[model samples]
Target: MKTIASTNSSAFGEPGIFRGQARFGSPMLSDYVWPLLEIRGQRPGPRLCVSAGVHVNEVSSIEAAIRLQKLFDPKAISGSVSIIPLVNQPALYKYSEYICPIDGKNINFTFPGSKGGTFSEVLCDAIMNEWCAGSDCYVDLHGGDLRENVSKFSIYQRTDDAGLEAMGRRMAMCFDAEIVVGLPKDHMQRPGRPPTGFARHGRLALMSEAGANGLLDESSISFHVEGVLNIARALGILDTPMSAFRNARVACNDYLWVETPVDGEFHAEIEPGMRVTKGQRLGAMRNLFGEEIAEITAPETGLVLWRMTHPSLPKGSSVLAVAVEETQVGQA
Candidate 1:
């Protein structure tokens, strides 16, 4: 078992960066080594964990994380921050599909995993046990995958612990995303949820989304960087004041997912962040002969959270997700 050295030093009180590898699977099929970045701050405070690339196709999140690691100066901060910019190394290296090619599992859905399970599960176990076991706050950055087009949003899980739930909400708000989603506690308790993997263990956690089509954009990268800085300020890691925003943010408590009824080529008429009334036409699907196979419509008056960008979709695949607008007039 390879070990990472501690970064604490009392002489000049400067931040230390430690880069190391964590073992993942057996040597028979193939061994995997995951990279870890440990950044220790000058003064003592809470430990903030930021991770990206849980889904390898989310290029913007990975780019943002890399930029964040370079931009942060431990001399100006109070606590330690650990970043794992590329969690799914195999997927990133191979440019694999949405799931880990080795295990054919989505790492995001298999968190707090078993040590003796599949490759993805073992990696998840290592991250939970070694990296996030005692974290004070956790932020998982994500973007639209290679085949998705999504609007900017942040999500926090609803938990029984009021304080943890509140902290998660505050972090999501500090992100200043166009939309803030509060996932229901019941849904979080269901099997294979990512944020719940940390929240259920008493860690305050949330996720942010931006970018799409497996591409990197400057705007998306900047949005994620600013969000992390805001989170640092909100968590007291950074002494700087919180930044202000011009537009009022919207809060979403529920969302509807539209799935493909048949295998075909999809053509979307609406884009992310567009508001549509119930029954409005959103998209359509066509077969090779150009015959329309399906017509997707809005289930309710709400905001389009995400849409499928890849034209070819299998039956039952999700075409888009809509966040239902709340009737109340305050932030959730």
Candidate 2:
């Protein structure tokens, strides 16, 4: 357990207090918003905003945000840092499945959202209009889906945006995550669809993936917390030193997607975070008849970060996993 400083507290309703709100408008309904603002040091620094619990089952992020909030005092930090511990309040109520019942939408996909629409849509619109209006950068935290087994990693948009990429690299370094994914092949595969990405206004964002949803993993929670702290250090919000991996940075073009070739029971031999070699058997697909019909192999050498959890798989369903590849941090 690393220690971080918590400086003076701000008077409620004062100029620089980090405040939380519930109703941005009609459609957007979050049970509560936990907003904390930290101002430290002297010179102006970048404003970094972090959000968690976009998906209710992915509760590790929420824990991470809470831990981070306790570590530092807003009035003592160098720059502005806003922490939103739980983004999907409705879904988080009882560790429910994805999407809020109020409007039933995934907040991540509805970015720069609608003014008058579903609850999630309204929440996105208000967040974008208010807290995220002029953010320097943002971080969207997450974990594996409820029905999947995934490891710790960080996802960022693929591009040659030098400044953004550099910042992303530093943030990833702090996490010391197993894999750092840089592209979205699925989004690219679809002709007109812009990639599965994130941002508040125009800042480059980092989407962190940790353990499987619906289960609490302490290791995952610690990893997420440390990662957020590193980001705070990078942005100069906190006067703490960098984490262990302040030098090593990994770059991956994209993660590999493994799909069910045939309908059968998915007997995955490799769990999340296992390193795999190219041409290796990732897992075997067997039908209810107990007959092994398909052998899933790695398309390229990489780490297995995410895998389907269900025993049965439908033909053509994705049973994908991610791997980190070797690459230099060239000028983007």
Residue-level lDDT of model 2, residues 262-323, one tens digit each, is 98888888887777877799889997789999998887777786888886889998886756
lDDT of all predictions: 0.77, 0.66
Cα lDDT tens digits for candidate 1, 135-222: 7887889987878988888888778989888888888888767778877777656434456777767777778899999999887787
TM-score of every candidate: 0.89, 0.79
Off by over 4 Å in 1: 1-15, 23-30, 328-332
Question: Lowest-lDDT window of 10 residues in candidate 1?
Answer: 5-14
Name the lDDT value of residue 54 in candidate 1: 84
Candidate 2 TM-score to native: 0.79
